[model samples]
Target: MLKPEIKVLDVQGQYRIHTEFYRSDTAENTIILVNGSMATTASFAQTVKNLHPHLNVVLYDQPYAGKSKPHNQHQKMLTKELEAQMLLELIEHFSANYLMSFSWGGTAALTALACTPRRIEKAVISSFSPLINGPMRDYLERGRRCLADCNRTQVGNLVNDTLGKHLPSLFKRFNFKHVSSLAEHEYAQMHFHIEQVLTCDQPCLLDTASGIEIPVLFINGAWDEYTSASDAQHFVQSIENSQFVRLENTGHFLDMEHKSASHISKAAMLGFLQPAHAEHLAASR
Candidate 1:
């Protein structure tokens, strides 16, 4: 219930990254959270609260996003390579023992771990797609046009259309809700993110999956719009020590699945971060 201590760090000498560190009284391991394009540290409010009782948690705003300041207005778009570098820096700075990343953040986490497996003890990556597929590409283009014109209605419509198509049969049976409207500044940030999505030169995660030796848990919504659950399964299969889980009737933005936050995702995270806790849960059940 209390506010987290906000800290700013200068990484790579130029980029000022905004971060929040929450220390747990229980003295459990630390977990770092990497948010998606549309998310900031605020987005993980519920997940942080759920995990804070047992594990220290760290969440940060990516460069130019959230409260983090960019190097300049004309700075180059974010790439997985850059994200990986930043994450490695943070891992060293905080001595993070685990990583929990969502959406594109997963790509960066995977990249960092593949490059340096010992950086963290384990990782939980959800809804991460290394490359955009045809439908996702079309959705991004449509979102770009809508964002350029500042058409909030169109952007909401596009999200609903895409999410509806990906929601499980139970969700499709009910009337869909409109995606939440973004503030002007948030809209601008999203526009910037879409631009990066358009021009991202990062290679597919499968290319680097083999290099990681740590245990990874890949979570995907059974009917996620951006990336297929099958792709997540394939990713898990590629890694000898990785596991996969598909949350039923869920889509992308698993955090939004519950009004407060994602209980399912948090459970998966707990299982990964505290295997003993997970076994305790299993034994109790």
Candidate 2:
């Protein structure tokens, strides 16, 4: 079982943000897992649990997800600045140096890191795209339209529809004790979050990404409906020192359904993160 310990972080206005920490103190490179919108860090439970015992791992819920406190109604997260601030808060709170981000989170996580270069050591993106351009772009637009119209039922229905249509089996995999028990605000927040994702300023970050000299890893599902291998190739070609991995027979959700996103894959990452000696071991084998 994944080692999960509840942790609390104090942020602005004395607000408390809570998350599940998968602790490892004997590690060298510490990894911070960030979930995509409408999801929590619980999604990574199976992946990080079987990682190299020498690497530290942490999975934290964003401000609006899981036990993390939502931002103040007056002080919102519309702009990249607010999102960057939240990223800084989490990094400072945990003193984490590496990031493992998922889908739309790739954009937000990149925004956060680019805004504060001093915070992150390196980053890995699973089923991620720094730019939104195609169907996901259209879907997000539709979602924001629904949010602006205050269509909470539509919002709820859309989430259920997407899961049923694209990931029926995955929906069954998550026996969300709390997510299933969510009330109106939870549902509304989902709508608002979709809207936020579609509208957040991200081009600046994408432009700045070309200059980030960190070891960025892009992991994509071979069958992903959102992003394909070309996207990964383009991302790596554009960003300095970026690497791309295409996992077989998986879709938009990598960390959830892809074997490469599981604990087994974490072992691969462990080997890659090691020094030149381990790289030699991997090559010789």
Candidate 3:
């Protein structure tokens, strides 16, 4: 039931990133949490509360997403590299040692961690593909069309349908009763990111695998509709010192379960970090 201290960070001396920092006395190491494209720090509320007892957790809104939207006044469009640089600065500022990310944030995390492996000792990345796979490409296309038509009904339907498809068994876990709660500016930002995802062809992580010198743990649902389990395997195989764990009876939202403290996702993360820390301590001895 612990809460994070809110702060506005000036990353890379350019962008102002809004972040939440949670401190824990029983902490093993600091973990930087990167949320999915559509998510804010609130998306990781339960997970953070569960982890705050044992780990120092930091959550942030990426540029043009959530609370950081107003800080993105630069003329240059948001790109993976730009996001990576901002993340690196944030990590340095916060003195965090571990990186944990979901979905699009995974891409940015991978890129940033690859470039600064010495700074980030370990990573737990979930549902992130190095490339835009076929299914994801199709999903982006649908988003592109939805943005082009500028229809609220179409947008709501598209998002709900996509959610239903990805989270058939767990759709009720989310609060989608107020899709209308999304503000106009937020909608435009979503459209812009979708366009970038569709148009940008640059590989975010796989190409820079050689630069990642730290241990990595990749987590994904066995039935993730947006990304295949094979892609998670590909990431593990591509990155050295990387491991993959596929959760059963789940979809893309691994942390979406509306549980209190003992969710599988939270356990898996704590398990990985604890053992990794033990190994680090042993090596130091």
Candidate achieving the largest lDDT: 1
Candidate 3: segments with Cα more than 4 A from true spot: 70-76, 163-189, 199-204, 258-262, 276-285
Cα lDDT for residue 17, candidate 3: 90
TM-score of each: 0.81, 0.78, 0.84
lDDT of 2 by residue, 146-212 (tens): 6566665665565445422344455533533334455445456656666665665655446746666
lDDT of model number 1? 0.73
lDDT of 1 by residue, 1-285 (tens): 867778889887768889999987875688899987656787677778778867888999887666775433425556667888899999989889888888767767887888764659888888876667777899889988888787877876676678445544443333122234454555566677678768866454577776677888888787685776776766754578888887776787665565433677767778777979877876997
Prediction-by-prediction clash tally = 0, 0, 0
Error of 2 at 117 (Å): 3.5
lDDT of model 1, residue 19: 90
RMSD of each: 4.6, 4.0, 4.4
All models: lDDT?
0.73, 0.62, 0.72
In candidate 1, how many Å is residue 218 off?
0.6
For candidate 2, the 10 contiguous residues with the lowest summed lDDT are: 71-80
Answer with 2 or 3, whichever has the higher TM-score: 3
